[model samples]
Structure formats: structure tokens, C-alpha cells
Target: MIRIGTLNVGSMTGKSREVAEMMNTRRVDILCVQETRWRGNKAKEIGGGWKLLYSGADENSRSGVGIIVNSELKEKVVEVKRSCSRIMKVKLMLSEEVLNVISAYAPQAGCDEEEKSMFWRELDEVLTSISEEERVVLGGDLNGHIGTDRRVISRIHGGLGMGRGTKKAKAS
Candidate 1:
């Protein structure tokens, strides 16, 4: 099976090598990276036989997302979609099936409501656009709160989450 993982790099500058090494050590085939803070929509080879496909805002370096593919699966990449600075997707051909890998960075808790709404709306659009027959692997920093207490949500949460739940988390 293909191993997939997610990471919030904070900023990708000067950290490609470290990221690649971590992936190799963990034996991860695909990694979704967030908060890259890089400006541009492009792909780069970050050594250790890994490739990074990223998308960032042209005017700022605040938000970005990317997907890292190891050498074994790099050649299977068929399409790349840079939805925005906060979202990106890569399609891979695995045998007879298609795998869509999406990397996303949601607005932080301090962000305005409008920005948060837009981020969620855009993410929903991207997710809905894909067909059900295709495989989907979505990973990212969604900026959600599960609270330290798992008594209420034990079925979905594993009791390792930190912090207290906010009104938003309770509403959801």
C-alpha cells in the first residue's frame, strides 16, 4: 500500500532537504505540505528522489500548499492543479486507478470570518469536482479544534487532542 502523510512546514525556505530526509526515514510515498509561504506555482525536485509540486500567492508569502512525491511514484503523476495559495492537487496513475492527492492550508483561528468561509468554500468546490470513482487522499492543516476532552466525541476523536473546544468546534 502507498503511505501518505501531511506536514505543516511553516515556511519551505531552506527546508527541502530536511523534509525529504524525514519522508525517506518514515517511508512515506506521498506527503502533503502546508504553509510553504513560497510565491509561485511550480514544481521542484527536492533531492532524495522526491519532487515537490507547490502553489502560492503571487503577492504574498503568508500561505501555500504542496505535495511531495517520492521517486517510485513521481513518474506516475499525470496532472497537477494549483487551486490557490491555500490548496493544490496532484493526480497520479496507480495501475488502473487514478489517485487525487490534495494538500490544503486553512485560515488560522485569528483570521476573519469571511476569509475562513472562503477557504472552506473553495476547499468544498475542489473536493466536489472530483468523481466518486477516483481515489482521494486529502491531508493538511485544517486549523480545527477537537478539544482536550474526548468524552463527547470519543467515537471520532482518539483522546490525544490538546486545547479546549471553542464555540466553532462545538457548533460543528
Candidate 2:
């Protein structure tokens, strides 16, 4: 199985040096990053050993996301779509698996419910448009809580409470 990891960089000053540094230890084959805070060639030049295909964010603030894959791995960028200054998409190919990854940092606040709702609605539509033939792994910071605590979610859905504490072994 290929290795994949996601990290919330929390506003990187330049190329997300701190985030990249921490990620280096995991030796990940593919890394999905959020809150990169930069764009264009500047972002590309950061973090060696990986081909950075990314977009989003503006010149003043780096509030976007990207996909950093080990260059040694033979792959192609199928697409890179930016939803907003905060959300971006990176579609890639790995081995026999077509990996479609999205890195998102959503609106967080009691007053931003409208914004959150709209974003979710649009996202749902975007996801639905994809055919099942394509394998997808969308992940990112997602600052807003989605009703249930995410960590508690199991590989098998609707079976446990949030986190390892609430899980029970599947009956034989």
C-alpha cells in the first residue's frame, strides 16, 4: 500500500518549511498539505524530494493548500483546481490508483454558518460529479466540526463513536 499523510500547516511564512520539516520524519510517499500561505514558483521551490503541484492563496496571505508527492514516484498531475483562496484540488496518478486529493481549510465561527453551508453544498456537488471508477481521497484541516468527531470514524462507517475509545471489534 502507498503511504499518505495530511498535515495542517497553520500559516506557513514561506514554503511551509516547518511543516515540510516535520513531515520529513514520516517518510511519506504522498503528502496532502493545508494552509500553505503561498503560490506560484515560490511554492514550487519549497520542500525538496517532492514535486509540488498546487494553487490558491494570494500575495499578501498564504491561505491555500497543495499536494507534495515524492518526485521519484512516477505520476502525472491530472488536474489542479482551486475552489477559493482557501481550498484547492490536486488530482494525480499513482501506480494503478488514480488519486484525487483535495486540501481544504473551511470557515470557522458561529457567524460563518452560511459560508460553511454554501461551501459544503458546493463540495457535495463536486464530489457527486465524480464517477465511482475513480478512487478519491479528499483530506485537509477542515476547521469546522462535521456534527460527529472525525477521529472516531472507522473504516467501516456507522459502527462506532468518535475515536478509538468507542470502537468494538467486528463480530466473527
lDDT of 1 by residue, 33-129 (tens): 9999999999999998999999999987679999999998999999999888999999999998999999999887667889888998999999999
Candidate 2 lDDT over 108-165, as tens digits, reads 4433557778767766765776668887777777664333333445333332233444
| Sequence-dependent TM-score of model 2 | 0.69
For model 1, give the RMSD to the true fold.
6.8
Clashes of each: 0, 3
Output the number of the lDDT-best candidate.
1
TM agreement with the true structure for every prediction: 0.84, 0.69
CA lDDT of each candidate? 0.90, 0.63
Off by over 4 Å in 1: 147-172
C-alpha displacement of 42 in model 2, angstroms? 8.1
Instruction: Please list the Cα RMSD from the true structure of every candidate, rounded to 1 decimal place.
Output: 6.8, 7.9
